[model samples]
Target: MKQLAIAASILGLLACSPQGEAKLSAAPEGFDDSYLQKMGFTVETVEASAIEGVYQVITDQGLIYVADGGKMLIGGRIYDITGAQPVNLSENAIRQMRQKDVAAIDGEAIVYQAEDEKYVVTVFTDPTCGYCRQLHNDLQSYLDKGISIHYLAWPRTGLQGSSYEQLKTVWCSDDPKAALTAAKSDKRLPAARCDDPVDAHFALGNKFGVRGTPAMVLPSGELIPGLVPADRLLNTIKQSQ
Candidate 1:
C-alpha cells in the first residue's frame, strides 16, 4: 500500500481551531501551504475529530487526522470510543464519500439493469480477474433478485497493454454487455476502439482504494472488495437499507 506522509504540515492543521468549533477557513497560520500539494492531496474538507485538538482531514484519496498543534499525524480508521461500543467514524465518512463518488457517475458504466429493479450497485471490475469473471457469469442471479449492476472497467494493468486493450474492446463493441460477458469468459473480442470511459473508470477505482477487481459499491457507498454471492449481496443490501 502507498502510504501518504502526513508529518510537518499536519501540525499546522492541528493548531487551528477545533473541527466543529471552526471550519478551516484558511491554510494553517504559519505552515507552508505546499505540504498538501507535496502530499498529492487537495483539501476536500476539514472537520473536528472526536478527540480534542485533533482535526479530521478529508482528502481526495481518503481521511487522516492531525493533532497536537501539528506534532502528530494519524492515518487509517478512527474510532469513537466514547459510547458503549466503539463506532468507526472514519469508515462512516468513507462510506459517505463513496456514495457521493458513485452517485456522480454520468452514464459511464455498462449497466445490466434489472427488469424489476429494486436496488442498484456500482461495480469496478477487470475482465482478467477470476472473481470478476465469476461475477459476470452470475450477473443474472443478481438481476433475478431485482438487483441492478452498473459495471465500470478498471483494468488492473492500466491503459498500456493487452488487458487495457481487451477491456477497451469490450467497452467499444456494438453490444458492450455481450462483449463484457465474452471477455470475462476468456473469449476474444474483435479489435475495437473509441473514446471510451475505461481510463476514467480506472482512475475512480484507484481513488476509491480498489486493490482488486469485482469491487462492489453498494447503494450506501460501502465497498465489498471481492465477489459476493447474489443472494447474500441482496440480503446485505436489504440490511443496509
Candidate 2:
C-alpha cells in the first residue's frame, strides 16, 4: 500500500470529534510523562478510543494504545470489529509510522541500488547475525533482479556497547559499503568514532517491530521479519508489483 493510504487507514480508525478535530488531552495524573516514557511512549497527544478505558496516543516514537489512562500499553496488532471486514488498526498505523521513520534514515542507510531498479526494500540488519550475513552474501542476486536494498543498522544489543561501536565504525568509515562488507565477513573494522546514526537506527528498528536481523520492509510497507531466500524474495517483490 502507498504511504498515504496506510496513513489514511490509521486516521480512519482513530475516534474524532464532531468538529473533525483530533482530540488531544492530558493523560491522567498517575499516567504522566515519565510513566508513559517508561513504556516507550513520548506522548505528544492522547485521544479516547471508541472502546472505553482505552486511549489512542500519538507519540514522538509512534502511535500506541494504552489502558488505565496510560499505565498499561499495547504494542502489537489491534483489530476493529465493527466493519464488514476486520481492519488491522494497529498494524496499519505501525506501517505508516515505519515508512515515515525509515524514510528519514535513508540518507544514513548503506544502499545497494540496482542499475535499473524495479523495487526497493528497507532492511534492518545486524553484523553479528548469521542470517544477516547470509542475506548480505546474496546482495548481488537481489541487485541483479532489480531490487534496491537499503540497509539500516540494528545491533541486537542496545546502544553503548560493542555491537553499537562496531556499527559506528562501519557507518563512520570513509567507505561504508566496504566497511560493512568487511564486518559481515567477520573482519574487524579499525576503532573509530564519529557522529553516527547507530542509536537512531537501532531505536527506529525497535519502533518498527524489528526483533531480529534480516527483517525486510517491502515496497508496500508490509514487514517480513525473517531471512527470505533470493528466489522467494524476488517472487514477493514481483507479486507486490
Candidate 3:
C-alpha cells in the first residue's frame, strides 16, 4: 500500500479509539506490535523515544515513530533546533545503525587496502551497475590516497534473479576479489557455491538506506549515495571527521 494511505488508515484508527483509553506504558517491556505487522511492516526493535509517550521503532522500512499504544504512526525525522544548526536526531539514529551493521561485515566484504590507510569506507555495490564497475576499476585512485575500500554485495535487482545469483557466485569463488573484478568487467565467472554472505549484505544495504548501487559509508558513518570519485570521497571523509 502507499505510505500515505497506510498513515491515513492508522490515523483513522486513532480517531475511533474510545475516549479516556489507557495509554500503553511508557516502558513497553512487553509491547505488542501486531498492528504494524498487519500493516505489512516487520518490526525489529521497539524502544522509548526521547519524547514522552512517543516510541522509536526500527523496522525493515527503517526507523519510525508510534504513539497511542502503537496504533498511531508518525513519520519524518525529529530535529533538535536548540542549536545554531538544527540537529537531526533521526539521522543520528540511522548513522549508528549503519556503523554497527557495516562493522559487522568484518572480513566478509571484498577489501582493497591502502599501504598507509587513513580512512576505511564500505561500499554497497552491484556488478551490473556501470558506476559500481567504474568505482571498482578506479580503486587505485582511492587506495593511492590512503583510503581502503570494502565492497559489500547489493544486487540492484534485489535478492533474486541473475544479479543476485552472480554476486553469490563471486562471493562463493575461491578468489572473491578476482571474481568481483571479473564480474565488473562483464566476464563470465565460473559457477560456485558456498555459505555466502550476499543475502546478509543485501539486508544490510537496505537497512543502511541504500536505494542504488555505489553507496558508500564513510568511517564517520555518513552515507554518500551514488558514485563518488576517490579524491572527492577523501575530501568528504576529511570534512566529516
Point to the candidate with the largest lDDT: 3
Off by over 4 Å in 3: 1-27
Candidate 2 off by > 4 Å: 1-35, 38-40, 44-54, 60-62, 67-76, 82-84, 238-241
Each prediction's RMSD to truth: 6.8, 9.4, 6.9
lDDT scores of the candidates, listed in order? 0.73, 0.73, 0.80
**Position 184, candidate 1: lDDT:** 82
By summed lDDT, the worst window of 10 consecutive residues in model 3 runs over 13-22
Tens-digit lDDT track for model 1 on 1-241? 0224333243222111111122234544443324443445555566667777777765544566766544455655678898999989877877887788777874878999999999998999888899898888888999999999999888877667777888889889999989988888888788888998787677677666676788998998788889999999999998876
Better of 1 and 3 by TM-score: 3
Cα displacement (Å) at residue 23, model 1: 18
Q: Judged by lDDT against the true structure, how good is candidate 2?
A: 0.73
Q: Using Cα atoms with residue i matched to residue i, what is each candidate's TM-score against the true structure?
A: 0.79, 0.75, 0.86
Q: Which residue pairs in candidate 2 collide?
A: none
lDDT of 3 by residue, 195-228 (tens): 9988778767776677788999999888999999
Better of 1 and 3 by lDDT: 3
Off by over 4 Å in 1: 1-33, 67-72
User: Best candidate, TM-score-wise?
Assistant: 3
**Per-residue error at 159 for model 1, in Å?**
3.7
